[model samples]
Target: MPSRHPAEVGYGHVVESYVTRTYGGLPRCLVLNGGRFLGLRWWHTTRFTLHLLNDAAAITDEELEALLGYEWRSRLTAAWLIGVDRRERFRARIGALLLASEVCYSGSAYCFALARFGTHADAEILAAYLDHYLPRTDLHYDQPAALGALLRLDAVLGTHHSDRFTEPDGLWDQWVKGVGRLGYPSYIPTEQRRWADVQCEFANDWSRP
Candidate 1:
């Protein structure tokens, strides 16, 4: 293993810190150092994720699995680590978490990981998530995030899995029913904001093929 930098984070520490963490954050912001990144400052509670990307080389699958068992922020960080490493084995676990929707704010990270995998199987997982959740308009899950990831995979692989969902009167159309009204509490969740931001981060900083 490479020598651990004094400032680099460890996977074990990340898995344990979720017990008292706050402010769910995206991995893109975490590494890119933006305003909304979860672990920007190490002195504060949010720094559990700081230097996590730098520590990716030493991360183990078991460590990631442990992280998956925690709350939303840890799961989000774990998923980001998994996606960044392209650890294909965790695809099913990530899909399961996205489907379970046990908590809020982490669904987008799961979607980002699925998109990172960019395989037909990942598309299927995203499709399955859409099939199960989009119809439940009563619950606001990661519908937009899953839909966006599916569309991205379909475009890359030239498949039509998302066509049915995107068609008129489809689940997505139904889910989008409450947008634009002045007093309506819910609105159509757009994936572009989170999806595009994370995608750009991976493409630009992959250290290239």
Candidate 2:
């Protein structure tokens, strides 16, 4: 992580100014322009730009869609960078993306975002995704990410549905067994580890009164 925030850097300042001037200070513009700015193309600078957008008080649907269209890695990173307060506004849109058959790592990113910022309805959507993907033997990385989201949701909301399909414990057990059976590959382990970390962080944050 960059010690200096995005606003502290010259390129960051320039991007912010452009967004304020050209887009009436919408945070979404900052996100879009940050990606377009030649000076901010480096990984660290881009991460800073995402931090800037994530810190925004509000982001419009149009803005988010634009962000989602960014490079796959950046799009996934943006999903995690977004603040929880703004998650609800993007939930339906993110859910739509998650359900799309074509999405890959970015879809998993949407799952992680929902775990951090979703409501009960959002949880239901994640559960549906988990139910849809968990059974396939072909091996998909997003399944673990989806399971992680469902687990986090259960931790935040308390156990609502006790059945195997919806319950966190059951889902977790299934994921573990599935992983064991399939054998851990490089990408699979990475995603599973990330999911665990995300779940822990979400649980900690939600525990705060």
On residues 104-208, what C-alpha lDDT tens digit does candidate 1 reach at each position?
Answer: 777877887878788999989988998998777666667777877787777778998888988877777777673313243443334543463456364335442
The CA-based lDDT of model 1 is what?
0.64
Pick out the ten consecutive residues of candidate 1 with the lowest summed lDDT.
1-10
Against the hidden reference, what TM-scores do the models get? 0.71, 0.56
- Tens digits of per-residue lDDT for model 2, 22-83: 32233434433233322334444444444444444354444444455544543554564443
lDDT of 1 at 118: 83
- Each model's lDDT comes to 0.64, 0.53
Predicted model with the maximum TM-score? 1
Off by over 4 Å in 1: 1-12, 16-52, 178-204
